[model samples]
Target: MKQHPLLLLVTLTCIPAWSLQADAVNGGIALIPLPDSSIAPEVWYHGQRVLVTGHDGHWQAAVGIPLSQSAGDDYLNITGSSNKIPFTISHRDYPEQHIFLNNTHQVNPSPDELSRIHGELKQELDDFAVFDGTVDPHALNLTKLPVKSNQVLSAFGLKRFFNGEPRAPHSGLDLKAAEGEPVTAPASGRVLMTRQLFFNGNTIMLDEGQGLISMYCHLSQISVHEGQLIQAGDLLGYVGHTGRATGPHLHWSVSLNGVRVDPRLLLTPALNASLLPH
Candidate 1:
């Protein structure tokens, strides 16, 4: 019998024996438990496909909570499931950061520059919306470091002011690296897109399969092209002070199901601990 996707989801989600286990905080990852191990179910949240993985006779969907998401009740719908899995997102207070840019144009562009900026923004959105399912789902290990730098200059979710004017929050992690330092892929994946933007400079976006994507920006050089298959530690580019940056550094971002989350969340515990203050 060909069961409807939603019907199958309902059956799997209704397994009362298993419960969803995941942190419910801004920039957190949600692990939605599934009832059946035999069937790989499709999970969706806000119209984007969620990443699913199996363990110990059960399956779970890994959903990234965007820092911009408002606090309070939220839900993810399993395609074949009759009911939505309820989740809560708690509030998080990120520190504020102010930066003075020598290039005032980056903060406020001219009319001609504004048009170019808008075009780049549209292209970025299109790249992020891609969900590649053919790549091996198990290949994603977000904890791997793309560059050998423990010096974190800018943390994620930081509210920023540019030259006394409020700007968008910092969406990625900035690592202190010298210009011409090589940046590698943190995970095995295929290059989905690459762009040189008004703000990001040279950038490479890797599709890690199942809605997991990683981006490297502000590079002095880009070695990989779009549609290239790359493994972990493969050279994608070199760090630089390109685009709107203040100095030479690598800005790395990770997205799950189209939601940008803290790149620190993907770092291994040991690495994370070492980076913390004493």
Candidate 2:
């Protein structure tokens, strides 16, 4: 489950260049080779802006394919370019996971809770959509692991049946941590949100420009405030089972262009290989 080498990021993490020959799989990233341009061309997919940067001798777009993407033809639209960048996505069948929650309210929220849930979901989506065209794309490096742990990521994209009922697929990587353990920022970014979400509990969302965002959820405490700027390794919160969680674990999510992809794809090669594919 190693990922294709990233032009800007792979050198920092020693992952072999060929292990990820084809990254265009479901719930993965599609590194679409782009045309040579003095300035990176703006790319878009389904209305969301994409991260286009220098790759080798040319430019490319590292698209975050949504888990719901079909295994078929997909294209990226280069702004003002008539020709589209066509890439084929391969299908990937992620395994299922079942969890029994004693909290009935978590398994099924009340009508009032549902209303608040919808609002929180919308706020998060809006935060994810901010592209931050002002920031330098290359300066935004995603090379650090938020939590230091010997255990690799084993649960991501799990189609969970919570309390015998189907729920949304797990959208983030879970790192087993104890209560009060420190959680830090993976990259330099401005904190977009620090709120208690319905299912996320105490959450902190960071925007790293070019629509590359990170969210740390299910915390016992939030150490940062909204609009605060933080660098790599800066503390954002502490681990806790604050939201709809079973235990004290950091639910770390990395969303590119507003779509949730496998977080390990952006990790160092050694760390990436240790983490199993979703």
Candidate 3:
């Protein structure tokens, strides 16, 4: 039997059983409980402060496991505590994809383009690392779909090869849409960046606070500005093939603690709205 994709928006007063809500595989989010405290406990992993939410002494660190992480036991450093909290993750294999492009530059860029890409990469890293501890992480609602089209172009974590050369694994979910289709914000967040680059083209990065953020790429138009506060279901931009894309599509990426994870794992479908195709 197939199960309907449901959105479980958790509240701080009552925490859900950690295990059953989300998978703990690589490129996934793990909600690990912390020691009881009167307030939220600050958790750190790999020198980055992880997102800690919930209240009334039942705090949990929402750790974003890197896609390259191995399936093994890991621990987090909680401030003011000498003991480390432990957690385990299982392994999951993703399939590979080989894409053919007629333009060789799309697969391999020139020296000048490479230099531009290097600068862009640095800016992208800085954008992803934006973590505002002020906003309560729980206040961010991320269950909404960024695109209404049910046509998903690609899934997350697919080992991808372009023009017979291997590239980075797909870090975002790509959705097929019309050239002028409207893209919406899935949560309430402040815009961190809006830029046009070599690969992503017109891009918008949103900070959902507490080290959680999202990115919309390959956009034809950008409606919001940097530091703009946007509500859920608000217009973000129009979808198009602005970057190194084969066709009109939207690339949606979700990150936690500077790590990109599977966006599907964070989204919940509405009534009769199908989840990403298997």
Candidate whose TM-score is highest: 3
Clashing residue pairs in all predictions, respectively, total: 9, 0, 0
Clashes of 3: 0
TM-score of each: 0.88, 0.89, 0.89
Residues 1-278, candidate 2: write the lDDT tens digits.
77655643544323223222228887788888888765668999888999766545567788888888889998999988999889999988888988899989889999999999999999888988889877644323345567776354446678889988999998988986789999988778889889998899999988887888889999999999999988888999898989898888889888888898877777656656665332
Question: What is candidate 3's CA lDDT for residue 239?
Answer: 93
Candidate 3 — which residues are off by over 4 angstroms?
A: 1-21, 55-57, 138-143, 269-273, 276-278
Model 2 global lDDT (CA atoms, 0 to 1): 0.80
Model 3: weakest 10-residue lDDT segment is 4-13
User: CA lDDT of 141 in candidate 1?
Assistant: 36
- lDDT of all predictions, in order shown? 0.80, 0.80, 0.81
